[model samples]
Target chain A: MTEAVLKVENLQTHFFTKAGVVKSVDDVSFEVGRGKIMGLVGESGSGKSVSGFSIMGLVDHPGRVVGGRILFHGRDLVGLPDEEMRKIRGRRIAMIFQDPMMTLNPVLRIDTQMIETIQAHEKVDRETARQRSRDALGQVGIPSPDERLMAYPHQFSGGMRQRVVIALALAVNPKLVIADEPTTALDVTIQAQILYQMQKLVAEQHMGLIWVTHDLSVVAGLADELCVMYAGRIVERGPVGRLIDAPIHPYTKGLIGSVPSRNPRGQPLTQIPGMAPTPIDLPAGCPFRPRCARASDICRTTPETAEHLPGRFARCFHPHLEDAA
Target chain B: MSVFILRRLMQSLVLLCVMTIIVFAGVYAIGNPIDILISPDATQAEYDRAVRALGLDLPLWQQYLVFLSKLVQGDLGKSFVFNEPALTLVFSRLPATLELAFAAMLLSIVIGIPLGLWAGLRPDSVAGRSIMAGSIFGFSLPNFWQGLMLIMVFSVFLQWLPAGGRGPTANFLGINSSLFTAEGWQHLLLPALNLALFKMSLVIRLTRAGVRETLLLDYVKFARAKGLSSRRVIFVHVFKNILIPLVTVIGLELGSVIAFAVVTETIFAWPGIGKLIIDSIFVLDRPVIVAYLIVIVLMFITINLIVDILYSVLDPRVRLADMKS
Candidate 1:
């Protein structure tokens, strides 16, 4: 088996708001192997984004990683100094954000920003860095990258901006790239193209990817493994095919059933009852108990950890597949 | 790009005209046209002659047209008390004010940004909080009070520098007064430091806020997740976004650097344009006041233009289809 390029072990992140502490990412763990894609699928406020932030060491004031081990290529990253982390970032690992503007420097031309991003990691002259930047831009399917590089971020369409951001992430050919819903802001057509480009780059470069998004369809097509998060905890995990085809957790089942394409035409869609539990005031035992259709009296008192399958893990008092026949 | 500039220029001209009208109305409201030029004991003929000489007998519209034409010819009329051309007086002192404004702005950015970056990168730590508190104090304290405190410390007690004035009287223009000579720079140090301190606090606090906000952006997290160093996360990903909003404040504040210098110059007896304006206001020097008004307006318009151009250059979304083939 290939070695894992990124491993997040027993991570916990909390937000100390004025009201109370919100356990945004509670005791979650996952790994992405070399050249593989790991999908973190959850709804808004489910802490999927928080988990990504924890891994990146980007948690801000009032929100912090209280406990965790972020292992990138077998090195601990939790308390690493910022200067050292900077060297590793963009060189060995790269990230693309959901908003292209966030990833870009608005006052800089595309070429200038991209070239600077590349040179930040590598010791290359201007011409060499420029060439790499051009190649990366073209690889992401930007037309006439040379000319486009002279333009600023405001000149590009949403799709094109995302493409530029993707190109920047790939410029250094890093071993790992974390994409936080990179195409969420784009139109469907553009989203498809970006996804295809990202997949192609991951394959061609043999790099690991963590694709964080709520869209199950995108994850289904792109990810090798899937981790379903609910209320800051991993509710279910498995191979993408197995998880979607035969989901174990009730939440996962509801999520899959609720997808419009999965239901019959004009039929009432299946949705998990109840709202997502607030991280600040989560119920005892399993976080999903309030909404879990299969939940029993025992689910209210004691949390259950799924017996790890050979290659998958889920947390539940009563996983469905074992009794599904 | 050209269109953007032209649009801004037209807007600036209209704004300037409106500002000039406001100034004229303010001046007209203070005293009757005849009263401004003739004594109470003067005969009716004397009053009439003075009114006609000043074009005060014309209709308001005609008066405005003459004012506009005179302005176009670079004549702002004579001072009511000093009897000097306003344009000449304003022009003569323009360089000194520009120097002060430039000096203050440079000081603010040079000291504020790095300090704020350091404070933000470690918000929870003692050193970070201390710096933040100091910056807050700097921002909150009145500029005049800060200037006085500096005078007490550096001039009265320490006696390390002169109390006030542009430079030593000896060889005042003998290459020593131009910031080139050691003595000239020494003389400038106190005023520059005072200006820097006053504005530095504001920019620092602002930068801290900007950095803190940018820290949570998904792109910054993505960069961190890529195992990029904290400096890169802060400088490249975080700082870039932080700087965009900060630039607006910085540009606007550049005008204030001159405005605020009035107090600082008065305290130190520095020969900057702010002091000149104050002197003109006391003597009711119309030409000097008008010229000062025009210069101030021009400064603000130009700074805003630079900011807009900068935004378009840095952000691709600002430009339309111009960059695309």
Candidate 2:
């Protein structure tokens, strides 16, 4: 892995609203290696999704990447011209949204959407693009691919629609895929099925996948490595097994503790004490300090993210590093 | 699909009956048309004979039955002023208005939607704000006033177009229409623009609002991430989604424009049905008036049916819902 599939270095995405500048993603950094499944774990407003958008150069107006180097297979994506950025999107990196129902244009047939995606990056004829679309559908395990291609988004059930969306993303054979909670809207069984298929796809294709989600459980089962975000920053990063078993950053600990399965069935679930700080009024130091029980006088400033142990990173003055032994 | 169409036609049939009843009652209450038709110095016998000949002497309900029965037999009555079949007169005038309505609609859709999309995409930009502000002027100005202003500017000042009247009409498929010739378009431009002003503003507002809301959706972000060019993203993804509302509004607007282009037609002295109806109303030409209204109702019914079909075409969800029921 001389060059990871995608590497985000010191990414800062800010929203300049009337209220003030909202640092939606502040000083976040991570990398997804070849065939690696990296979980970008965070609750709502934690910037996990924003980080994904930033990497794709899809940040809308009022919010922008002010600082960062999004090296996709070694080329810097930050401030890339629209033409160049578009060339990379879908061709080299694809994204899946939380809801499959909304992703495909409801008015268009499945073939039209997929064909358009293929033709957008490649100079293929309509029939060729359509064939690629059918192949993509088959790859995602869609039954009767030809018939499904002719169908519209609404014709597919929830899980089937998600599979179509995944097919759309994988159609281009991109080196990296950013999935923003693509399975969150499905039933448990369907979610598990999609996750398994996606994991299999990544391994077989040797392409990196960034799974952005708030569900630690889903990522715990899916991701090889994990980055825990709190208030627009990656507060901890490590292999999933070590990160979940011996979590460091306080927010990560609180998040892991709050999972319903982690707590005893008869007991009340662990709850984080405060709502996430609004990006506009983030504390001068650690944005999570107010909600952190481990906050001390020395934790009044931002701690640098660095490797505290081999291949382990955390931005905390007092990370639970006793497990490093 | 056939079942849906059958149900819609049944609904339209009931609506048509109700409309005819209301229109008949409303017109009957507008006072005696015979009074206006007869001269003040005409002999009593002459007046009675004239009334009897025109069938105005019949009771209102009896008159309606006569009218409805003749309608069922495909006779739409005769224009008292023109001494011709009411349906024939209307059909002759229809092409003028149809061409005008189509032109106006074309102008509104072609100009309105893209401007609205641009403004919505960059709400804070100078062009975006200016476009929004200009649409306020478009919708706020009175139709007659706008027609007068258009005539003043293009005809009076610029001398770029004709002041009033329909230009030379060429027969196309046995339908004499001025829209076939370039000189016809020059004569048409002012009146068409005037007729379209309000509708253009409405399309702009609705498109802007829809695009603004749809832009914030995860699907739009996903479309962008798929590396599609902004052109494809906005046109295919965003535009297709927003068109549901636009199609609904445009269908209703087209019907209204054709039915109510009275002010523009009058201002330009364009020989459309709007002008015909106005004159018919003044002379108390009951046959023509009734015929004109029926045509309008039919047009509205047809437009609405087309709208429903268009909805199914533009949004698969509508078609899916149709299937479920």
Candidate 3:
């Protein structure tokens, strides 16, 4: 197998609040190879976003990576100093946020921000930076890149702002881009366009990607590999096609089944009855034990990530595909 | 954009007219000018002659018209106390006040903003907490008291500097190297510190809040993930976001700095517009009072206009939104 560009091993990120410590990301492990796209899927509070944040070293005060090893190209990133981390952040690894407004500062012109972003990672003159910024905006399918760069964040519609944000992410041409629900705020139509652009860039640049979101449909359309998280831990890991065709964990099955189009027109859409349980007061055993349909006495104890097939992994007392035989 | 500017200008004119009416009414309500005109030694005939010569006997409408016309022609009349044109007195004193306000603002931003950023980025650290505590204390303490304390420590105890005044003597023109010659800076230190202390606490508190808010945004996280150094992330990505609102605060504070100079000047015995206005008020110099009021109001309006223009330049969205609004 090609060496992994990024490897997160047994990571646990906890939030220390007045009430208690919430295990936002607990013992989650995954890998993304060069130019590969990993789809991270889970409901809110499943720790997918937190895991991405941990890898980025963006966790702030009161929330910390208590135990974990974030290996970026074989180098441990967990304990790396902020000064060193900054050198890697925008240059080698980049991130796209959910809200495009966050990515584009409201006070700065589009061109100014994009040019500055380009020059930040490389030693370049204004003309070169401007050309690169224009090219980036063009790559993201922004029409009339020259005029648009002169405009402000408020001038653009929600979708356009998102596209501008995507353009900014592409400015430095980083090797890895972590997109945390980048299209969640965009309309469905705009979402499709952005997704297409993102996929095309990753393929063209051979950059590794971690796409975090709760929407499985988006993952199905975009990701090469899939990892399903519950509470703060990954419950299943496999090829995207295999996971979609035959998901092993009950939690993964429930999620896939819950999709509206997954069922017949006349039938009721599947729903995970209760809200996502709080990470602060997670139940004993598997984090999904409270909602798992196949839970038994054995499930009361925390289950470890166990390999069920040649390359697929699931954290369950009774693996579904194995039992199907 | 031009339309927006035109609208703001019209509004400013209307505001100025309204302010003029209020000032006129206040000046009239204070009492008749007979006491000064007709001293005990003067007879009724002499009093009448004095009143006629002063145009005091003219109808209120006529007096207002004359005053407005003179104002339109850039003639603010003569100062009763200074025996000079009101505009000349204001213009001369204006530089000293502007210098103090500019000095104070520069000191506040230079010292407070960095401290606030440090505090925000490391909320749990000793440096962060100490900065927060200092900010709170600075904001809470009365300006007068702080000015007194500074005077006591820097002037009385240390005897390293002059207690107050524009300079050792007001004979020097602008850019006197004597101030930079070591001895002159010593004279400026106390007044600058006094003005700065009053404004610094505010900048620190506001900056802390602004930084904290910016830190929460996804772009900051994205910046961090991209491996930008903490300084770059905080100053470049985060500072721009925080500084938008900060600029607004700075503009408003500048107006207050001019208005509040009365107290600061008194404490430091500095020769600025505030002291000039105070002395004019005590002497009941009508032309000086009216000229001072008009000058201060116009200063505020112009500064706000500049700030408004800056907003559009900084964030394209704002200019776009303003067009629609």
Candidate closest to the true structure, highest DockQ: 2
Q: Is candidate 2 or candidate 3 better by TM-score?
A: 2
User: Distance (Å) between predicted and true CA of B218, model 2?
Assistant: 2.4
Give the C-alpha interface root-mean-square deviation per candidate: 3.7, 1.4, 2.4
Displacement of the residue A305 alpha carbon in candidate 3, Å = 2.6
Ten contiguous residues minimizing lDDT sum, candidate 1 chain B:
B168-177
**How would the candidate models be sorted by DockQ, starting from the highest?**
2, 3, 1
Name the best candidate (by lDDT): 2
- The best candidate by TM-score is 2
Candidate 1's residue-wise lDDT over A219-317, tens digit each? Answer: 999999999999998888889988898887888988999999988899999978999877789999888888887889888875645645656578887
**Candidate 3: where are CA atoms >4 Å away?**
A1-3, A71-75, A81-84, A109-136, A144-157, A160-175, A205-207, A322-325, B1-10, B36-38, B69-84, B168-186, B320-325
lDDT by residue (B1-325, candidate 2, tens digit) is 8887777778877887787788778878887877887789999999999888888888989998998899899998888888899999998898888989999999999999989988898898999999999999998999888888888998999899999999998978886788778899899998889888788888889999999998888677777777777788788888888989999899998999999888888889988898899888887788888888888888998898888888877777776335532
Off by over 4 Å in 1: A1-23, A27-31, A57-88, A300-313, A321-325, B1-106, B118-154, B168-198, B225-229, B232-325
Candidate 1, residue A144: how far the Cα is off, in Å: 2.7
* Local lDDT at A321 for model 1: 64
lDDT (Cα, tens digit) per residue for candidate 3, span B235-262: 7778877777888899999898988877
